[model samples]
Target: MQREPLVLESAAGPHTIINSKEVVNFASANYLGFIGHEQLLNSCTSALEKYGVGSCGPRGFYGTIDVHLDCEARIAKFLGTPDSILYSYGLSTMFSAIPCFSKKGDIIVVDEGVHWGIQNGLYLSRSTVVYFKHNDMESLQNTLEKITSENKRIKKVRRYIVAEAVYQNSGQIAPLDEIIKLKEKYRFRVLLDESNSFGVLGSSGRGLTEYCGVPVEKVDLITASMGHALATEGGFCTGSARFIDHQRLSSSGYVFSASLPPYLASAAITAIDVLEKNPDLISKLKENIAKLWTGLSDIQGLSIASTPESPIVYLRLETSTGSVKDDLKLLEDIADHALKEDSVFVVVSKRSTLDKCRLPIGIRLFVSAAHSESDLLKACESLKRAAKIVLVNHI
Candidate 1:
């Protein structure tokens, strides 16, 4: 199928122009409303004028700058990790970070639904990959036991466990603490992708490791797209000093690719500063999530995901036989009606073969601290309209 061009122009927080009409944006990754913050913009602009565009070369060359050190230091301290490394894209961190520890024949037990980055990276590593039921500890343990009992040749191969802190499409959280408890018995390294939880989870604003009371050392690696909650460009991996030091020389993703530029790094540094200064931001963010969750709870035909301590929400649509479909007829029907009539924009899954797509009725909504009570009320109103549109039209 051929596609038509869809233009987007942002006017205000989480709202944008679609084909020239301004509509509320429900599909953005900007969780904390930092994209357009005056201070952040000012910071980035100043750095841009000072540093110019782009890093100009990979960090291995002359591109490494004071701003890079500034941001990484602040992030390391903020997340309670000793060091952090930046990447041009969040997905790059996934490939470079996870493969740093593993080699051929190593066993990796990954959550069935981790974002494709880790899956693809692990595949490239040629490590033996095992899929455990999503967030199911028993299943994961079974797999770990099987790998652990193997011969000495296989025993030399290490095991790593990977999962998201808050699943994006489902708005659910992983059982991080439960998974961590099993690490000791299984001797498996744990990796967390905190794209949705960092800057939002802990009472102190650390990521999932902090939120779960797990020390920073417990996690072998922490990688995420700062583009999400951190509201910065690129991705980062945080861990012990030696781990990052090793990656500096070994991780090709960082060594070959351009380093994060001074301007964006400066902005991220400022964003963390803002988060640290305003602990109330996290408190208010949770309240926003609670309000939305409470509003959506009583709806019929809605199967809510496990409430991870994050602010994303998903509404799974039912099929005639209650299954998945990427055609997303039901999703299109709901979104078209909601946009034209109620002005809501929710995401529908596009990948079909992976079974990630739900019944055409599935939709993803991103809640933000930028939203107000009245804004949430409008969102709920849009959902109610959406419910009627998908159900009544029966598309």
Candidate 2:
């Protein structure tokens, strides 16, 4: 039987109220624990009072608020990019930014493990899309070589290599250093989605480029959703000033959609300020992730799929049940048992029907700086018990 969607009765954080019971939350991507942060709340309130609730028009019209420009500039400065453009919605950032520069007859080499937002963007670009093996630099090189050799007009048409810094589906960090070398060798522009890694990976929370020690200018385009690390509602694309200027005029989402609310923009700006002031937040988050990984090391019939540096700790069955549906069901049962019986909230990798990626299904536990060692221990113990109960019968 299909279960009804779980409803939250309180604000999402390290702990949340669900069905009148408080549980340790591992379902949200609140990496910095900024959901109800006092500073961000105060910023939102001040902006709300000053600018009202809405922008009332698209950015091209009278909707370009001062806070939006400040947020964009702040992001550019944070990432060391020449400029950046903001979008009202997070998911739309990928779809709009991808198709903005890539048009028909262009070539795009992408990772198969990228999220649905990027998949949709590639489809909309009308470009010839090619998929390399997920995170396999050798496969990327081979694919790029094949494309270069096979297509005689490749030099004439625009070519882009798109990937996610930390894949949402598998929680794997991309080999960005190797990717940058390949892009330079093949003369391809790189469009990286840093939604999952922006504030989580780097030493100073500047995303993949900083994490990999690659200069910010190495990437041609970089986009990230503030929803993940910043705990804000919109997204931004950062790169050269010329590229941003072009996106302002051509990107569908930025050109046609309403400007992001002033409060959200203010919240994003404040989030950055908070992140910069307190670099220790990243350290605390890393420590929490380490504690969770250590606790989950012995989970029965399951294995960790995420990298040590990743906040998204993905748990997959040690052996597949041979069917995606069956595997998903088992994972869901474990998640449900952990939530209902043990008061630990977790989630399965529930893919959209529209998503055509071939990655395996698993359970994803989003770790946060706010999660205490005790909270992680509780989650680990609960998951272990739930997994044994769910998998024993199947075995």
Candidate 3:
């Protein structure tokens, strides 16, 4: 049987109206709580009044507006990269970017727990793609050694290591420092997806590279979605001037799709401005994470899967039902009860069977800087109660 999806009547933030009822939202990816920000709203409104609603043509044709270019330049400056390219949609960035650099006969060694976007990119690349155990340096080294041995007997091919800075599927931070070391040893270029890490990690919110103390030059390519922390639509890729220029010409999504709305582009620029002016937001976010972690740590039958520093918190069942589908159903039940009984909303992440992710299914609770102490406490209490009720017999 099919069920209708819940309809949200308001903007997604720490609290939202779902099915005409207010609930503390834990499912939104608005990490820094930029949604409904007054300055951002005003910036977007100004752009809308000036530029109308949409850019009807692709970037190469007639859609290259000043706001689009401004947003790209602002992102490049913020990330300390030479240049950047913007895409109209977030998922399109990964699928288009991977194929732009790596084609057939190239090699891509990726983490097993990467999200569907990165997985789709690998599929489109048509490259020799291999998956290492998620976040395991030893497993990555073993895979690298095997691939190196195999490539020794063949003609030279370009090699890339693709991973997410903060994994969407597992909520785990990739060890960028160690990954960079391994990349140097294996002569592999790094393509990092900072979708979740862009505005949530790092002291200044530059991303995992900054958080890990890795130089920006060490990363070959970096891609991220503005939808999360920036609280805006579209995505961006930053790298050397040559690499970004190549994408502008060759990336299918960038060259063919309509450019991002001028207002959203303007909002992105304003979002970066907000980050620059208020570093305290990032610290407040860290404090919220610590508070939420402490609240949820002692829950029964559920264990925390993410780290202390990660804003994305995952709660996994202590034991599975021996069936992936059934295990996910239990998690779904917990989410439902949490919302119904406690007015707390959360999400259970379940991958499509067609996908090849190796991470275990779990409930994903996104913590934002906007969430008050009461919101975090309520979610934890609700989840603990729901989990106990749902997993009572199994536990």
RMSD of candidates 1 onward, in order: 2.4, 0.9, 1.1
TM-score of each model, in listed order: 0.93, 0.99, 0.98
Off by over 4 Å in 1: 1-6, 151-153, 306-308, 318-323, 352-361
lDDT of 3 by residue, 1-395 (tens): 23456778899989999888999999999999999999999999999999999999999999999999889999999999999999999988988999999999999999999888888889989999999998999999999989988888766799999999998887899999999999999889999999999988999999999999999989999999999999999999999998999998899999999999999999999999999999999999999999999999999889999978998999898888889978988898899999999989999887776677888989998999999999999998999999889889555
Task: Tell me the number of clashing residue pairs for each predicted model.
Answer: 1, 0, 0
Ranking by TM-score: 2, 3, 1
What local lDDT does model 1 show for residue 370?
81
lDDT of 2 by residue, 67-137 (tens): 89899999999999999999999999999999999999999999999999999999999999999998999
Runs of candidate 2 exceeding 4 Å displacement: none
Among these predictions, the greatest lDDT belongs to 2
Predicted model with the maximum TM-score: 2
Candidate 1, residues 1-395: lDDT per residue as tens digits? Answer: 33342456664467777767777777776778887899999998999999997987888898899989888898898887889988878878888877777778787888876766777688767888888877778998888888777744554667788888886646677777888888888788988888888887888678787778888798888888888776778888899998889888888789898888788899899999998898888888888888877777655545556473567777765434354443356666666777778666666544535343222335777777887787677777777767775676564
Q: Give the range where candidate 2 is weakest over 10 consecutive residues by summed lDDT.
A: 147-156
Tell how far residue 255 is off in model 3, in angstroms: 0.9
The CA lDDT at 114 in model 3 is 89
Q: With candidate 2 superimposed using the best TM-score fit, by how many Å does residue 136's alpha carbon deviate from the native?
A: 0.6
**TM-score for predicted model 3 compared with the true structure:** 0.98
Model 3 residue 333 CA deviation in Å? 0.9
